[model samples]
Target: MGQDYKEIAIKLFKQGKFDLAKISFNIAFNETPSDELLAFIELCDMAKDSPSDALTLFEIYFDPANDDSAQSINEIIDIMQSSVQQSTMEIESQNAITYADFKNLLNQNDFRTLFESILFSTRIIITHKDELFELVNFLVDHGFLDIGLKYLEGSAKMFMGDERMELMLEKIRGKDENSLK
Candidate 1:
């Protein structure tokens, strides 16, 4: 049964159906836990969350004995950076939002950075929980409930067992439910 799921996951992964692949990989891991399968699951999760970081994930998971991959990964990073620059240029031309306003907003609140970071990255190393909870409440109060919910859902595992995180998760979940009505 585990092998069956693993096969399905591999196929899904090759097809770029990362979310489905992750689901299948999780099922496979639960049935017959292996480090390789777990790594694949992690890759699938990362791929689903940040498709642009796929090469980074590949570098992390691959064997260190192979050295040729570094140059290729560097090239991929360069290409990605170029693409991001082009997108930023396009956005700058079209959007009315000014750099000063964005800078001021970020400077005005530390949690806003946390919200933006968690929105993009699957994992973020955060040392401050007080600021995180404060940001969650601020976002929720300011009608950024969807962004707050996404950040909480993504970061909940890392901050698990903290009463504040749990409470905010519950609050965001309730808000999400109500908003759907």
Candidate 2:
């Protein structure tokens, strides 16, 4: 059974299905722990952690007309990567902008920054309404209710009259209420 899981994970990984591969690898590890499974798990984690992966997920969830957010996120990632590589030593200087500063910029209503932050921090694949609801649930579960609320509100406004937005708001409200209980 462990070998079956490992084989399935390897096939999924080769097919670029990192999330599914990670799950299979985790199951295999539980049955029979192995360094190879651990390595695959690490690789999946890295793939999922990439900003590009998040951008792809954003594209999958949002409408084509809303590509502006994804574009802005791509630009931010490019700028961040270049700046970091060019001034590795100057990162500690005031000239360098840390990730937290970037989040602050988003909170300041810098439109591009806000969208970029959403794409970077939330690996949300909002394909269906249920998926969007799940993303909000995840954000709340992870103690990012405030940030998640902001993004949900922003998305609701961006795609005005979206029924899913209302549903998501209701679900989030329920989660908030439950948490306070």
Candidate 3:
């Protein structure tokens, strides 16, 4: 019975149905208490709340402690990647929401609040050079110079020697300088 619930929870979790997964994990925990099940419950809660937080929790807490850490980490990574991919696809499906529309959104809402909400909630794994470039450009253009620079610097290893990435770094630096002036 407990194993049955655990299996259901895992399936739901992989499907990005964290709410249902959490309930299933809870039921499983009640039936057969274990640290592993408790961790899964906590992971489901965090993933439901925010994928970024879930990834952080898994990296900082679960990965180090678990005996079967590799499998656990892989599962969490899969969930985060899937969620990010789905979000990316949705944004793409909307035709990338024209720059003017996005600017309007930023103007109507507080940009800092909105940007922070996205930055904290989503674990953006840039799968393409274009995605990184576009994201850095958007951040810098929207006055998130520091964040843009941080992202550019962090991605430097992956994008090293890429002309577009170099141009983006220069653009971010140029913006940073102008802002300081």
Best by TM-score: 3
Off by over 4 Å in 1: 55-181
- TM-score of each candidate? 0.35, 0.34, 0.39
Candidate 2 global TM-score: 0.34
lDDT (Cα, tens digit) per residue for candidate 2, span 112-180 = 445456655443323333444555655666656776788687556444566767766787788788889
Q: Cα RMSD (Å) between model 1 and the true structure?
A: 12.7
Name model 3 segments beyond 4 Å from true. 1-113
lDDT of every model, 2 decimals: 0.66, 0.61, 0.72
lDDT tens per residue, model 3, 25-59 = 99999999976777778687657446566646555
RMSD of 2: 14.0
Candidate 1 global lDDT: 0.66
Model 2: how far is 7 from its true place, Å?
Answer: 0.5
Task: Sort the predicted structures by lDDT, highest score first.
Answer: 3, 1, 2
